[model samples]
Target: MAYELTDKDLLDLATGAALLGTGGGGDPLIGRLLVEQALADGCKVRVLDPDELDDDMLVIASAMMGAPTVVLEKVPSGREAVAALRRLEDHLGRQADAVIPMECGGLNSMIPLLVAARADLPVVDGDGMGRAFPELQMETFGVYGVPASPLAIADERGHTAIVATGADNHRTEWFARALTIRMGGSAYIAEYPMTGAQVKRTAIPRTLRLALTLGRTLREAKQEHRDPFDALIDALKQTPYEHGQVLFSGKVTDVSRHVSDGFTQGHALIHGLDSTGTMRIEFRNENLLATVDDRVVAIVPDLITLLDADTATPVTTETLRYGMRVRVFGISTPPIMRTAAALDVFGPAAFGLTQPWQPLEEIAN
Candidate 1:
């Protein structure tokens, strides 16, 4: 049976989703506001387990794809996201029975809630990537050989494109990125059509509940005047991977950004409070690598999270800026991200470096 979501649930979902975002998902604040508005206007978000989906039911994954920075500067028209989904449905000749979060982190989690409330469809309580990733092909959808093509991309300006291709997911990622750049560096996308069975087999199950639990833990910890990071670390320790370490706690001193090949490329320098060295972070709409004193400390696949030093709130790649005090935390990557195939696809070399990939746990330990 499907479940109904309350405001309390939304809070928890955001918390857990941020932890999983691995430092790349956009901020959940705006998304949470959108959902809150919807709820106030009498929109109720319904959630369903993967088992509740019918075999013949059509399902679509939706998310905002772009520079998380740009998303903040140019607020969404609110309709563009769901409009993209509807356009995809029109092209597919079927209505999506359930909407699923493309990734379980930050804004992506809340996005589906808004989409479900607006579309009046039930949202599957699962996600493609249990965490956030930089590209379209980073999710389990790609691991499962699900194609992201025939995707519908829509902008706040009402520009829309339905791209179809027979190429691989990498090619699809390149194409969608081009379209997104053409649409001013950000757009709402709906792709990866799958059945309930496909969803059940490929998705990170019970993610919504996980998100809620994480969020609630943070909230309750704050209410009790406890260390929020302690709560987060505790919750994460329950998961499979090792919780590496807390490298630094400090304020952002500089953010250098520019457009490179139609993508946002940048680096942030964070001033440390408890350490003698400064932390430098490089990103491509996601934190890709972190270094201290010119030594690489953490890299992608293994999670590198930035949080408000005081409140423990997550800071997205786009929102990272000068003068923002933050804490840096590392978690080992899941086994999938460490695979040879996955590394070739997303490692430093894939991002244009000739350097060999090193596990975060190794460096931190």
Candidate 2:
């Protein structure tokens, strides 16, 4: 089924994207504002289900690549996103049949929508990464053998570059990262151009809907003066992520974070409210590992999100600070994302940890 987005839906979607972002993917507020402006300008965007697409349809992924900290200060002009999309379309010698998000987290989730509205094209209701990852090559599309090249990158200043040299995905990341740093540390990208059949085969399905639903669930729970965590985990039960469990509830005792190699990398220490457990979380744009009392509680490809305990708002790495009360939880990734092939691209080892990727449920048990 196809549906058009309303003004309020953007709000909920942004909120949900932030949670799904797992402390990375740029800021959701920026995405929300851009989409809000598009809607205000009377650009009606429709979201088409993957099944609605013909096998021959052309769908391209739109995203922002850079250090999350930099994007916060040097906000995009929105033109960059459109420029990236247009550049890619020109290179392909065909207008995109639909726009899709590289990841359904934070700003990436909304960029495709913004590009779709601006280009007068429909946006697909799915994404390559069901949640955000720091690097371009980590998406399921790449994991499933979709080439990342023919990628178009554009900056806030309207400067654009294309990676069409037939580089492998890792080299593609290197080229794009170099371009992003030179373009003032952040960029909008349109890449992984794929046929509808490839999308159905590789993209995680219905993640846009999940992002919207998550926002709505938390918002409605708050309105009713209910516990948003309970509401949120319950909401997860109905999605591809399945049920999530709170791993620790505590106050942030310390945070060590910095931007390294075009990525935000760091760790945080949280002391349990009951003073019994201490949670240490390590991250690279997105949370990658979590340990309590030196025992691994959660690790990469699984979702480790920090939420404001009282309000249940998702906290990104950029905003984490000492003395904040929070609840941390881990949710399973989609099965496609947990496969051995997928793990080779984004598992703990990929992030410099030796622990092998295991089912989140298995670790929880």
Candidate 3:
């Protein structure tokens, strides 16, 4: 089924995308406004399942790359993704058939919608990462050997740089991050141009709908005065992410944050209210590791999301603070991300942790 996004769906989409962001992916507030404005202007943006396209059709991914803080300070002009897409098409000497999100995080999840509306293309219902990851190369597309170039990165001022060659996705990330820092700490990007077959194979299918569905479930639960955590898990049960489980419920006791290597680096401590333990979460843009009093509970490639204990609102990494009552949930990544090859790129090892990869289901048990 095709879903056409209008102004009304903005809040739900943004809220749900933030939840899936797993404490990173930048805030969705600004991106939400951009998509809302585009929809209000009558720009047609429809979400299509990747399977709806032909195996040979062309599609490209679009997203914002930079410090979440910088993105907030330097709001997008909404032309960066469009500009990058056009440049990529020009390089390929062909028009794209559709647009897909590079990641299913807060800002990124909505970015392709804006680009699709502007480019007059439909946005696919799937994304590279089931959730968000801090780095460009951490996406499922990259994990499956999709090249990250010929890529384009553009700033609000209309300045753009095209990377015609990237040795690998890692090099693409390095170059893009460097250029973004020079482009005033943030820029919109169009990269990983791939075929529909590649998308269907590597992308997490129907994640856009998953995010919105989870958000709607939580919202309805709140209105009905039910346990939103139960609603969230029930929602996940109907999707590919059936491993969702609440790991801890508590109030944040401490937060430590600073910018390291142009990425938000931080850790949050949640003191359990009823569980008699503390949950510590470390992050570099996205939550990479979570532990209970120094024993590993959840690590990278497994989704670790924090939500308000009462309303179930998502608490982004940048907004987490002392004394906020929250519940933390762990959701397993899609099956594609659990392979040995995918783990090497996005596993606990990728985050420089010594622990081995453990499925969230195993940890939950």
Which numbered prediction scores highest in TM-score against the true structure? 2
Please give the ranking of all candidate structures by lDDT, highest first, separated by commas. 2, 3, 1
1-365 per-residue lDDT for model 2 (tens digits): 99999887998999999999999998889888988899999998899999999999999999999988898899887889899999998988999999999998888888888998888999999998889999888989999989999899999777888997574999999999999989888899999999999999999999999999999999999999988888888999999899598989999999999987889999999999997689999989999999999888889899999999988899999999999999997889989998889999988888899777777888865
Predicted structure with the largest lDDT when compared to the true one: 2
Off by over 4 Å in 2: none
TM-score for each candidate, following the candidate numbering: 0.91, 0.98, 0.97
Give lDDT tens digits, candidate 3, residues 230-296.
8888888778888788888899999999876768888999899987699999998888898998888
- The regions of model 1 sitting more than 4 angstroms off are 240-244
Once fitted onto the true fold, the runs of candidate 3 whose alpha carbons sit more than 4 angstroms away are none
Backbone collision count in every prediction?
Answer: 1, 0, 0
Q: Which residue pairs overlap in candidate 1's backbone?
A: 12-212
